[model samples]
Target: MRLLPAALSAAVLGAVLATGACGAASADPRVDAPVPAAQVAPAAQAAPAAPAAAQEVLPQRQAAAPPRPVSSGGASRAPVSDPGMDAAADGLRPFLLTPAEIGPEFTAGEEPRPDPATPAPCGGPGVVAQFPFAVRVGAAAESANGLVQETVSVYGDEAGAAEAYRASVAGMSCSEGRVDGRPAVIAPAEDLRADLGHDEATGWRIGGAGFDVVMISVREGEVVMNFTVLAAEDGLPALPDPLTVAKAGTQKLLG
Candidate 1:
């Protein structure tokens, strides 16, 4: 995704810092700022509407087949049931939702599955999921002077997955660990900016700037999904928290 350049003259910088400090306390950093009138490219389009939920099937006994007619005068016919076709169809049903329909909000740029023939990405080894929501953002590095690239993944969950994700993200700056045991890394945004100066364009405000980046993951049955937000930093002025806005956007997915 492309980052748009916001006007950041000295006057704007001073106002941003003053306002940003007050924004630090809010749940989302972006909320304080008016939602930009211009259409910022959405990380991705809203997902398409989902198909109607599948209907439940009841158990039933198979009927016995009648004997076949003699070949000499019989009409040609084919069996209605095919186990192989049924299995293939069943395998593909879960992945039918398009990426937009899979989540409330997501980033752009879908990766090509290792196997193009299959709709799903490669499963098993190094596979985060048959399908996963991937969002990318540019954040400040440890110095706060430069930018770093980060990717967040949303996945299907089982048990202990949410806690595990939190722990994994917590260990990111200090340890070599991965989200869901896949090779990845994370660093606290505040810690990254400890020494460097803040810039409005990069979305880092110094001193009174109270922004916080939080990692959130939710688990429902078999789905474990993760996302991040920059929260409103309290003690400042009117800047909105980025995290809070992100959370509000993703919360719709739970419904």
Candidate 2:
């Protein structure tokens, strides 16, 4: 929900980005896309070969597009372009988890750019409110673990970051709040907590009728990072270890 405040990642890159993988799990974690997995082998009778004229040469050369930061579910297209967001980004870039840190298979999104959609935040006026500026960077990945997503917000100082962190954790009590942009209910997941000696660590299992999201957030200095694993309700399995996501994120930041 937007109540997530400054922590949104490409709207769902923060939440919805997990949709594709989670949808697959809840629907059928089967290999539906790999043709060989679902399709039967060719029939006993072979088709006649086409005339030689039917064959055509394929293009030998083509213009190459710029490489993307990520290839799959992560939208993380936005970068910190504005001075405010850039300031926050500059202060925390070293601490950001690289795509490799996010996952061995994870690809990055576009290079840093502005995210105007994320404006002033309110925890009642939240995390972003405590700082002159804040930075947000996010990426997504699909692993055997589940649909994993990460969104981080960097404030100006530890005091502001801590205040924002507290406000965000407290926001969990709201019976209804916007997620991405839609309204959803909030609930505690009652799962593992991060314990890497960060000044603060907490988690939440939150979602509504159609989906469930489990997230763990830890603050190291001015940086507050959250790693979330989620699924849709249809065939939703018992939520996986939010600790896995949390620790991965913490290690990325710490290392």
Best by TM-score: 2
Q: Which runs of model 1 end up more than 4 angstroms from their true locations? A: 1-107, 111-160, 163-167, 170-222, 228-241
Candidate lDDT values, in order: 0.21, 0.39
Q: What TM-score does prediction 1 earn? A: 0.24
Model 2: lDDT of residue 128: 32
lDDT of 2 by residue, 1-255 (tens): 322212222234335333422221121110000000001111111111111111111111122111111001111222333765444444444554565665575444322222333221111433333332455655444433234555666555778667766655654544444343333444442323334457776655444333445556667777666665544422124333456556766675554
TM-score of every candidate = 0.24, 0.52
Report clashes for each candidate as comma-separated counts. Answer: 32, 16
